[model samples]
Target: MKNKYLTLLFGLLLAASSCNDWLNVDSKTILTDEDISQYPELLETQFLSSYDDLRGCIQAIGDGAFSYRQHHLSSFTDDAANNTPWDAGVMSINISPGRVFASIFSQSKGEILTPVWPYKEINKVNKFILQNKDSENSEVQSLVGEAYFIRAYMYFEMVKRYGGVPLYSGSLDHINSINDRATEEASWDYICNCLDSAIVLLPETQKVATEDRDRANRYTALALKSRAMLYAGTIAKYGKVINNGLQGVRADAARDYLIKAADAASQIIQENKYSLSSEFGDLFNGKDEDNNEIIFRFSNVAKTGRQVFHDYWNMPYRVKKAGYTAFMSPVLDIVEQFEKLDGTIQPLDYSAKFSDPADFFAGRDKRLDATIIYPGGEFMGERYSIYRETRVKTASGTKVYAYSNQEDWTNADKVPGHESYMMSGYDGIFPNTSGGGFTNYGFYLKKTLYAVKQLEDYLSAENEQDAVIIRYGEVILNYAEAAIELATSYGETKYLAEAQTAFDQLRDIHGGLPSKTMTIDVVRHERRIDLLYEGFRYWDLKRWRIGTEMHNKQFDALHPILNIDETQSPTAIYYTIERVSAPDYLITRTKWFQERDYYCPVPTDQSPGITQNDGWN
Candidate 1:
């Protein structure tokens, strides 16, 4: 087995080094210097390989399953929940140092705890940049620029976790030269510089079907730049409590990073190359391709390409032939965050209008409906019903009412002009009943999900749905955040109104919210509503230095229970909010966020002097 693994790895390296008889390098391996210098065209293939791996290919390489880069983080945070208690269980808090350390080990240790120490991907990117840096060919130079963006992106992912990490942009070698960690500020500066170089060389618009959709273009670099700068600025400004990991940027640096964030986003805004599309549901549902709102996304081909796991994510068990236990249900606590549609600062409660059963989903911010499938809400011609078996005696006859598949009552309780049956006779909680992993918190996520007629291939990663990494909606929020921060702290008069203007774009995209203060909390709130299941909530909480606050609390899950009295003229249905874990099923679940969690433990197997984040061993 060891020999076979070595042989496969050797073949991959050889394929990257030299071309075959057909003058095409093997698709399995990446670009090598010999391949890049001898055949400059191979650089494009190698450069794009970084993206392909991060998108669809990373799933197959790292874990046995096709795990996404961002999916794991979503489970740890309050935004989403994974059913199996591996990491998402409410009981698993204060992660053991042994377990936490196991995940942060360097790549050379024969295991990867996380994507932070990505040596293979970086090696290819550095080789391309170094070999093609002096090339006079326009395309080769452009590839080099893209390589810069990729390296910068790699660094941002690393720095966010490890604070200060080793930097590399040149060719790999006998490595005594580049093992030292730079400060957090230095790493971010390097990321910004890479984007600055990319913006200078890459084209403005993605050429229709070819370069624009799959690869990063000029705007792609800017969009990421805006994203990183905003993060740096927030870390600089608000991250005061956990001070051990960050390498001490000056106070002014926070304002400077915010300025860069606002400016970088402003360039994209001024260019008008992208627009906030109103078709929120259709855009993510795979109905529209290369829409105007998407600044950058992974384009996956149907059967030939690797697939994603959107079908199994937060989908209701009611789907025909359901195998995926709804492990990833959207918790009800976050659902109420949506503002009322009347443009008022009212909590999202539809009980008053519950007289109209259909009104359960109406009148709230439309994004809620687009993202979450609540009990009694309709989607894909199927309504997700979470009601109990209700036995009622109508004036005419005895009947049992279920939200779905209503049945006739039996063993009725004799009454005057009315009849009733025991609720225990029928199956209760149509979809919320936990079986095969289907304990939903009364809601399912519809953001990354698409409705399909047949789901036999659903469990397999056979999905061709594109994984969206960054879009204009986030950039707009970033712009709004930076502007709002600068205006509040520094009293920047010019940005006070500009913040409102930028925020208004998102408002119009998802039916406008009522007038509200453009405070940082409000900006943070808007970000959660728009980017809920996209795996940004966890990072947003961390960057805002509010992880501990969120971790200390438990999320509430609502169960829609319907109770009907046969004696009453009309039946009454009630929705009850309850803890997801039943009285006996509860396993002491909690999220005990500590200061050390701010920075993941540094890989001990790396440099000797590399320190762990403040707390861990």
Candidate 2:
């Protein structure tokens, strides 16, 4: 097996180094200098490969699966649906190093961990550009432009993950000099400049083939730049917390960049080439192509499956075909944030299990049902219930991990409590081993998973549900957000005009919703519901400096979870009830006080010599 693996890897290297009479390259091949003369095709292929880099890093950093192994630190923060560890549950999250700070730091480290890979890729393409400078192929310039765009994209992510990182533009070699990390401000400026240069060189949408949707185009590059700048600008503009008891960035500078960011994003949205997906659910379906709305995404196919995300979120408690038992549960905080279908904040009592779907959940935003499975919700086109047969392991060596597949109506009294079924049936708690792996109680994610096996191919990595990097809707939202910030910075009412234009664009794409007045609160809310679970919530909250608004509270809820011991044995675990109703634990006002923690302290492990952000102690 080892020999076979080596042979396959060697073949990949050779294919990368040399073109054959067939003019075909293996998918696994790494690019090399020799492939430079091939021009646009080879460079384009390398450009697409950068996306694979994105996929690997993001799933590891952002996706919620395998607990700490796959970072879901945002879940620990208020952005997610907290389900378990009832006693100190949500409050415990405040200091849970593994889930919150550690995960954030790990994501930051991911930026630095494999810098060599992207650096090598950039070098391969750079070689092509250097060798073929005189070539008449107009495609050459575009391809070169794309290569720069790819490098900028990676660096942008790195800077966001870590405040600043080492910048590399040219090919590195044995004799090449290594550079130290740049200051955060300098790194961001360089990234923006690189993107600007690439934009000038890149082809407009008309130049690329349909099959090459994954490659960066001018619009995509601009969209990316808009996003990057928006993030940087917000942090700099609204920055309040002091580092070493010093202010971070001037508000004026922040506003300047924000206006630029808004302008860039507006350019894309104004292009009119992209729009929102017709149905919110369509965005997650793998079978969908790059509709007008999608600016950037992955092309997963059967041969190249990417089902890991769905597998982590669906339930083994219900799906007979699902080999894995555990489902990535939603944190309660996320659930609370969902507005009712009527566009009003859902009443707290409306979350009750027996609440009528028509009255409690009715008139709610369609997105709520589209994303989460609430009590008495329809899943796979059928009425679904969490009360089903379950097995439990007891300490006395009795494993009673079996229960009736019906709602426990026998406990008529408990039904009204709403606590018994809070978890949607599984052992409603975290570290709960209900279905299989470690799970947080409460509801599991079901939207991304397939119901019938027919949709299975599309649900996995093998399916081609493009992992959207940018789109028209996102651009619209950016305009709205940046407009608000710019408005605030300039003390101008026209900011409202900018914000209103963005809102109308989004609603028009969605067949036009009722018009409403503009406010920063409204714009922020729209951005949240518009782009949930795409891993934007955490960062979105951070940029707004609202992390403390979320983190300063404890979330405790009752739910069922599995109990497992060493050796992965299922022992009898008792089903206990818990809830957190304490006002101090549930309310978060700390963000109102110091604000700087919103940026998150850089991981202590990265450099102890560098002080953790002020007030961390």
Per-residue accuracy of model 2 over 255-372 as CA lDDT, tens digit each: 7678778878877766766667766656664435557777766555543444344434344344533433433455445655666534456534523433232233455556666666
TM-score per model over all chains: 0.81, 0.71
Which segments of model 1 are wrong by more than 4 Å? 1-40, 56-72, 84-116, 176-179, 241-248, 301-304, 348-358, 388-437, 459-462, 514-517, 570-589
lDDT comparing candidate 1 with the true structure: 0.61
**lDDT value for model 2:** 0.51
Q: Per-residue CA lDDT of candidate 1, range 1-617, in tens?
A: 54554454455567554222211223233545565566554455435657754452222111222343213345556765544344332224334332221132122324333323554556667766766678787877777777777777777777776677777775444342234777788878888898898888777765444547567788889998999999989888877523343543556789989989988888888788888878787667666657888877665457336565554544555553454354565665677777778655454453442433335556788888888777667677875555444545456775654432122212322322334433422222433323333443556667767664445655555446665677888888898899899998977656557667768768867656655668888888888888877767766776777777855556656555444444564555444323354222322124446656667666554345665556666
In Å, residue 1's CA in model 1 sits off its true spot by 37
Worst 10 residues of 1 by lDDT: 56-65
Each prediction's whole-model lDDT (CA)? 0.61, 0.51
Where does candidate 1 clash, by residue pair?
A: 90-589, 90-590, 91-589, 103-113, 343-514
